[model samples]
Target: MQVLHLSTSDISGGAAIAAYRLHQGLQHLGVTSQMLVGKKSSDDKTVFAPKSNFSKALGILKPTLDCLPLRFYPGCDITRLSLSLEWLPDRLAPKVAQLTPDILNLHWVCGGFLRIETLAKLNQPIVWTLHDMWAFTGGCHYNQDCDRYTSSCGNCPLLQSGNNWDLSHWVWQRKAKAWQNINLTLVTPSHWLAKCANSSSLFQDRRVEVIPNGLDTEQYKPMDKRLARELLNLPQDKQLILFGAIGATSDSRKGFHQLQLALKHLSQSGWQENTDVVVFGSSKPENSIDLGFRTHYLGYFHDDIALALVYSAANVMIVPSTQEAFGQTASESLACGTPVVCFDSTGLKDIVEHERNGYRAKCFSAEDLANGIAWVLQDGERWQHLSRRAREKVEQEFTLELQSYRYSKLYEEILHFGDREGIKSSN
Candidate 1:
């Protein structure tokens, strides 16, 4: 079987990493596979083809000037992406066609790379993984259930700041038209998301499958916490709280501000003197009453082993994100024997077992979050039990071997189904 996996980035965060792992797994199964991504990090091109300058330029310019009706709306660029649709396929088709894969497996189709129309021209079978709700919705990458995508999306819940054009309705209409024309299978990484897809009008009649994301357990196993702290030169006595992602602190979508407020609440309630926040990708705020000199800010860690150490050293890992397709950080933290604390919402709802492995704060409330933090730190024995369970959870479900095997099976089934349909066509 030949497969072409496409995504936004080559090897950055969870989605891209999963894409690469799936690519390697496909190769192991003796299938010819290739990965195409719009943007490659400085280190990524060493492995995959870096995007051409024209595409990169468009990636920059499209967002800047292509606001057809005005500047900046919820799904503005995404809805208007078809404007550049004609130019991209010609340049990308040869590279994608060169692989001539049996199936085109698309991951994260948003972010201004090959729009849905590009896939229409492909003769091969198409399998798209819904990493987020963007594919089903009119335009918003994440709908948060405003029901705009289901019917006609005129009054978008996520829209903000625009000109006279009420672009949401037009975008939704266009999306419905585009989706009706595409021939593909939809894969959701979580059952919750799959259910959401099935309920939505766009995917109501479409075939949808639930396949969970997999983690690399071998690299993320229980490292000695003390040794990890020692290697990193972190405090032995302080209760380390680790959190990270690509744009962890800066992204409003991450709810880092909420986490900060919760931390401040902890301080106000007299629980912050001993706590230290070890942020991986972004830094802690310099002038904040919630954090003091206790914060350890390690800006942009690329090494896997070092990241593992940070997770291992943490008493708890916090995913304070308001939205997550799948909380990869939570899984990674669990793999390192660190329990995760996240808000009770969306992708995070499935991550923690609510006091079994970790705690989920009542909601996005700062007080609730602080209380959850205090409860974990207060009882060392129970927290230790959770820590062990966290490791066990990853061993059973999130391991790389488990993930690769699952994808191998899924790929085989997709290929066989396509073959059977082709035979029927010939008949």
Candidate 2:
């Protein structure tokens, strides 16, 4: 079977990385898989991009072009929320048709890479792997406590618009008109997201399956703590707590503010003297607020080895996100044999077992988050058990091999169903 995976970018963010890993895993399992991305950063030959200079330039400008409609919503806080009305020029359908794959797998295709109208033009069966809430909602990626998407999106909170005949309604109408008859299947990386998708009016009748993102356990496995710290030039005496994301501090959804509050609570509880903080994916801000501990801001890591070493060097990793489709950071930290502490909500609850491999604190409670951190670090013997279980859990459940096998089975079932329908039509 031939599968072509479409994404906005390769290896750029969590979604991109997850998509690329699945592509690689399929190839490893001897399936014919090719990746087509709007922005290609790696040197992989199978990955394709727009060949023309003008098309490449347009691809870079598509995000901005898609967001131009937001200017009408003067009251909107664009920085705090996301909006994508995918109405820009997208010539991907013709290119995708030329490849002539049996199935087209879509992942994170929002930034004007594929227009709503183009879905009708594609002839092949589609398997859309939703990386966020964008596929079901009108335009906002995260609904943020709004259930408008469950019925029909309008008067969007993200757009700060009160009118029912607003931009969100327009986008929703476009989707309802364009995508009503398309042959599509939905896949989500977490049960929480699948539940959300099933409840959404856009995909309420569609088939949705839950599949967690896969990782190369060999690359993310643990290293010697002392040696990793020595290599990273981290102090050997102090305990390190690691926190990071693409925009660690700026993204409201990441809940960095919650983490900061939890750290402060830990400090007040007498853990401050022995602990320090390490962050990646962000440089120290000019007017950095006191985190109540010494902070090391390692700007960004481009490779997995550097990231794996950083994960190895830390005593524990904290992912204090308010909502996540799948907590990739927590999985990576566990693969590195570092215990994780995260809220017992969203996709995180799938990865962290309360005091088993790691700790899952009460949802949105900083005090519980602080207590979780202390519980993981209080005793070396218990910490060793947590660390061992963390690594074993990834090897058993989150490996690329297991993920690829499950996807392969899903693909086969979809193709078989299509064949049976074709036979009935011929009769």
Candidate 3:
């Protein structure tokens, strides 16, 4: 059966990487799988640059055509919409209408290309992976603190305007009406996200599957610690604690500021000298000021080998996020035999087994975070055991090959059901 995978961006984010990995995984299983991306971002060009300018222009135009509705929602990238119907191009419409792939597996369709109505148009069956909470709610990616989705959402809780597009009505009710007719199934990367999806009005009655995101195990497996550290120029003696903050100073959602605060507390308490906080993106936070912890900045390592080295050299991986769909970095670190620590948030809870694989601190508190870090650092024997277990967990549950196998079987089931249902319903 032919399968078409869709996503907003084809970059290296969790969803993009997940889509690409699934593509590779399906290929391994000898399935005919292809990718359909809304916009070709920078990574797309860098990763798959065309030899000619004509091909480059077409890449640019595909996303640009999705922007015609700016007259209504100016500056909004329609190509990035959630199940967007408004931007579905005539070129794609025919292929979608004709090929009618046995299954269309959608990853992250937020931004604009997919409006809610697009799902209703699909005669083929659909399997949508919930990378975040945006698919269930009115239109927010990460609802930090709001349970309004279980019922009807209005009197906006998370939005700064406290209103949804000047509508007095509940937006989710409208979304529910548009989405209820589709022959679609929901898949979540983490069990926590599955629970959240089940509680939502859109998917409460639907069968929610919890499929953990997979990694390229062979590529991410443990590297030689000494050689990795030497290649990365990291200190061998200091306990290398790796942290990934997307925007070290700007993105509050990442909790970079909170991590800085926790590290500050560690320094004042005389623990900074023994640790190193290596960050992946952007410049180091100036707020880490009095924290005498030696910092190592790897800016950003795009290649898997370099990333594997960073993960292998680190003694432990810290993911102190305020909110996350699923900590991809945590799984990657685990695949590299490095334990991870994060807050006991919804997504993190799925991967961490208390003190087994890693530590999950009290919901987003700096002191609690610091204490968790100290515990992992001081308990060398326990950490080593957890490290081995961490690798085993990834090998067993989170590999690209395994992910492809699971999805291939799921697609076959959906296609068979869709064909049988189509025949029966016609009579």
Q: How accurate is candidate 1 locally (lDDT)?
A: 0.70
Q: How would you encode candidate 2's per-residue C-alpha lDDT over 1-427 as one tens digit per residue?
A: 9999999998898899999999999999999999889999989998998878998898989888888889888898766557789998688888898887898899999888989888889888888899889988889888779999997889888877898889998988899899888888888888888889888888887878777888899899999999999988888998899998567667778888889899999998898888999988888889987787899888899888889999999999999998889899899999999999999988888898789989998988988999999999999999999999999989988999998898888788888877222111100
Cα lDDT for residue 244, model 1?
Answer: 81
Q: Model 2 segments beyond 4 Å from truth? A: 419-427
Ranking by TM-score: 2, 1, 3
Tell me the number of clashing residue pairs for each predicted model. Answer: 0, 0, 16
Every model: Cα RMSD to truth:
4.7, 3.2, 5.3
Candidate 3 Cα errors over 4 Å, as ranges = 41-92, 98-100, 162-174, 283-292, 419-427
Give Cα distance to truth, residue 287, candidate 1, Å. 5.3
Residue 278's C-alpha lDDT in candidate 3?
A: 77
lDDT of each: 0.70, 0.87, 0.72
Worst 10 residues of 2 by lDDT: 418-427
State which candidate, 2 or 3, has the greater TM-score.
2
